[model samples]
Target chain A: MKRVGLKDVAAEAGVSVTTVSHILNNVQGKRINAETRRLVLEVAEHLGYQPNDLARGLRLRRSNTVGFVSDEIATTPHAGQIIRGAQEAAAQNGLMLLMLNTGNDRDLEDKEIALLLRHQVDGVLYASMYHRVVEVPQRLASVPTVLLDARSDDPAVPSVVPDEEQGGRTATRELLAHGHRRIGFVNNIDDIPASRGRLAGYRGELAEAGIDFDPSLVVTEDSVAAGGYRGSRTLLGLDDPPTALFCFNDRMAMGAYRAASEAGLAIPADLSVIGFDNQELISENLFPALTTVALPHYEMGARAIFHLQQVIDRAEPLGAAVHEVLHCPLISRDSVARPRT
Target chain B: MKRVGLKDVAAEAGVSVTTVSHILNNVQGKRINAETRRLVLEVAEHLGYQPNDLARGLRLRRSNTVGFVSDEIATTPHAGQIIRGAQEAAAQNGLMLLMLNTGNDRDLEDKEIALLLRHQVDGVLYASMYHRVVEVPQRLASVPTVLLDARSDDPAVPSVVPDEEQGGRTATRELLAHGHRRIGFVNNIDDIPASRGRLAGYRGELAEAGIDFDPSLVVTEDSVAAGGYRGSRTLLGLDDPPTALFCFNDRMAMGAYRAASEAGLAIPADLSVIGFDNQELISENLFPALTTVALPHYEMGARAIFHLQQVIDRAEPLGAAVHEVLHCPLISRDSVARPRT
Candidate 1:
């Protein structure tokens, strides 16, 4: 059987096609009476006259859809929060989110971008699992793109990222204000933009205090749980361990705490430690509440959507790169205290 | 300029449309020579030939896509982990994931499901932020859906959920094995299936040990960090607080730890606590380590996809309810100990 169309519905309801379209689209405050609107809808429903999303998408030249292409979803906990913010903003702006998991494959990322383009998505949000510099795939250059939780060295794309440098500095400053002169740094091995930015912040604060940056005091390891554990072992094994330590993220902080405990050292007494990302588990689980910096995950997501909308509405070529940095605030929990003599 | 089609490419390459179709679809493998394959690809690229995803979707009656509909992506950290698992499975099967955030809005859920149907998605995986008895929307009865971390009273619909009963039992068994005769239970409101399952498991274990189940030892509250704290305070206020405590989840366990600390109690020495859902932060950050259960988030996601594939391939009725139950394993850390005199 042939599918029903708007003309059939209009003829069946004895109304004009324009009236039917207006009622179907739910045009607000239209002069149509409730009974006429109700009659048109009933006729359309009886005829199973479903609107063709593709045709509508073509005519409007807008899919009312946005694509969020990310590498991995599960491993990066922070990305989940960011997606939430973007989803909320997109919904508020009358758009639906079309998520594409690239599975961290370069080739697959290229394919997914092309697929989104075919679907006629208005814009795309390229979210990374970690804070790393990503080379935008060639296919996505034509599409309006915004990067989240990552940065690009090329100044052609817009990026919304956490202020990792400020977070690091704020965490260290809190430790310094508590009189921790002999401080240690736990760094991750990955050379991502976030890791580098955080390290720069830690160094800047230490230099401001006129303390010699001690290479011997820095322990580098993976950013994961096991990496934190191993880093802690090496740091504590040193002959002259620092009285306080700063960790890149909460996972490493936990590992550092465990190492200190094994050595029979007390938190905030023998060793004061601060961490970044203010993870929910870290702040609540530690014996001494973790004093850390909270990454602006939700805000970054919302802003990315807002920015994408701007690019789409202006129809302006996103020639120059746009970078929006949200500051990370320090939460003074029980983890940090004055170093005891 | 006119868009190029398979026929246009065939004419340009001096070959039959059938041969061009086979070459473009990469079906020539052993039948075609390497030179021919390279020539076809080069010509296709030069022509800017793009596959019509909509036509392909209709021809195969499969979109090579799956819809992941979740209540809220940001509210619960666990949802991200589940998505990761499903994504991996989808990638392995050469399928793409189309994500929709319902935000726990029933109306939105209905609309999203309708949209997914319009897209002709292969199948859908419905994930709730937390485990609870969800009413399967009537509109989704025709779609092949597998629920993750959530269940419906309707057994016909297959669901993949964590074994909350096992999680609770294992946590209780760990404390009991540690020789704690007097144990307490900290749980969320029992209206949720997870909470009920856990409470049942806890009671079953105590009965198995010939120990009388003490109603006074059970404390119920919200499952958030603050709720855990408040619940722990009440549990500790009892005249004879149990030597060990088992929390419904890690967030609540964090609260219990805080309350125990404020009451001048030492973990394992004075009070040992166990939690469920071994969330990354909760297990790692809990002082002395939190002995908890690891929810099979990744496995559930994989299974949901596997089940969805079966339904999609069969072209089975979309609204039929399917059910599945996944198991949880216990991760024994260092928090439990023997009862103290």
Candidate 2:
């Protein structure tokens, strides 16, 4: 079958081929009417007139594709939301994602980035599965790049990451609003942004509420269930046990649940608990579903693509890099309640 | 800096441009020495030589890319493993994945498929997050396509899916081997392939064990934690409650755990429980952990790419389509134990 062309669609729609091309290509600053655009698109769809992307890319020196290079995306649960957000945003601009996974291998990442450049991708979304600091690949210097769920020390590369401090404040405020003055915080021991920012937020929120920051009430441990269990046990054994607990993440909350259950304390009624990183599997399934703060994983992804497009549209790197911090909203469930005291 | 070309690598390696091109492009049938191939690759890497894939693709009429169109990959936790598997396999063959996600919208799917076809993709991988029967898209008929974790009624379209029945049997047999004569099956109410196949496996395994299939022991409900809890509660409430339970998935098993806990039956001691779909978040984080059947998500993804490559390399669809059913492996965790009879 002879492939349908723009001329076929133009003839079918009774419009000029240039009108069809302008509307379909989505050329900026065009003065075409909306009705004509719709008619051309409808006719093009009905006629199955697929624009030859390869030919168009070669002619224009643009692939209409973006490179999505991530380190270990497949192993993380958060991968789905981030990738989905980026892909959806990219699709809105008629761009496809050329997906590659590096498995955190530096050498492999270099090769993959080179391959992406070889494909003539208009830009690259250098994504990380989790929010952290990353040294952008050296090869990406030649192309427009945006970081998703990650940042670099250099101020010249754009990035988008969740506001971990705000997320912690959101979680802490939820517990504080429940009229609990003495709240325990089960924090991760890592010195990463999440740990440091969350701790700062916790302290800052408590100060606003006029609650003295009690060093004895805070315990740091590994950010796993076992660690949460151990930390919760120690906190509960204190001379003046906290009426509420703020867990670092949902996994830690799951451990706290077990700890509370073992100590014969009912959730919300006996001990209010709040967690961060509302991982649905843990937050939703736990008995008395956990009240937690959510990471802006999806937003970070979408915004990364938006930022990359901005750079690509400019056809040059911005004089100053744009670093975006997205808000982490509170997800209230059954785990938080007013303290009896 | 000017873009490095094939001639640069050839000059650095003291080889002809033809040898470099053949080695770099991996053109088969030319017996190039292994040492010279390594030398060319090293020189190419050191010189940062990047092949112009666009020109190469245009010349060869091959994109060296596979279109990966999944129905809602980002919403499901299973998306990561499947994509990783396919991507890793593709990378091994020097191919890249052009990813597009259609959130199960038919019109959007049609448009996306058209876009993929226009890119001159060598083939397409139509993937589903879960195992199901799918009607191959009409537009996909023109391209070499393979189904991942899905199958079509037409045997001519290649597919790869998990052996759902075998997974069920594995879970049931684990309970039986632990000396549990009567076991409860908490199955999903949906009339999908997983529900039917798992139920059939339960009955088949019982028959093999010379035990009459007790219709009263099986309860169907939603495949969520609440459903699992309700189903388990009902089964445990029976006058002659089974000593063991097999849940449809990890989420359901989490519910089963709650029911057991409420009934004062310790896991692996008084009530042995087994689940399917080894979702790490649910299974690993659940108290007492969870022994479950792992759906070969990664394997299915890798195999799908392998199958697509076979069809593509053959330059034609095989006379007989290959429908491969990979085995579901048993992951032994802390859940199952011998009955206290």
Calculate DockQ per candidate and list them.
0.26, 0.52
Cα lDDT of model 2 by residue, A1-341, tens digit: 24577889999999998898899988899899989998999999898777778878877878899999999987778898898899889989989999999999999999888888989888999998877899999999888999888899988999999998998888888888889999999999887889988998999999999989999999999988888888999999999999999999988888899899889999989999999888887788888888999988888888999999999989877999999999999998999999986
Scanning candidate 1 chain B in windows of ten residues, the lowest lDDT window is B52-61
Give me candidate 2's TM-score against the actual structure: 0.89
The runs of at least 3 residues in candidate 2 whose Cα sits more than 4 Å from the true structure, single-residue gaps closed, are: A1-49, B1-49
Task: Give the C-alpha interface root-mean-square deviation per candidate.
Answer: 4.5, 2.3
- What tens digits encode model 2's per-residue C-alpha lDDT throughout B145-249? 999999999899999999999998999999999889999999999998899999988999999999999999999999989999999999999999999999999
What lDDT would each prediction earn against the true structure?
Answer: 0.79, 0.91
Candidate with maximal DockQ:
2
Q: How much is the lDDT of residue A99 in candidate 2?
A: 94
- Candidate 1 residue lDDT tens string, B148-248: 77787787667888778877788888888989877889889757788888999899999988899999999899886677888888888989878898988
Local error of candidate 2 at residue B138 (angstroms): 1.5
lDDT of 1 by residue, A1-341 (tens): 23466789999999999999899877787799889999999999988676755445545666677888888876666767888888878877876677777778898788777877666678899998767788888877667889987777777789998888888888889888999887888988888767888888989999999998988878789886567777877887889888888888888888787688668888888888888887765665666778888888889889999999988887776667679999999977888888877
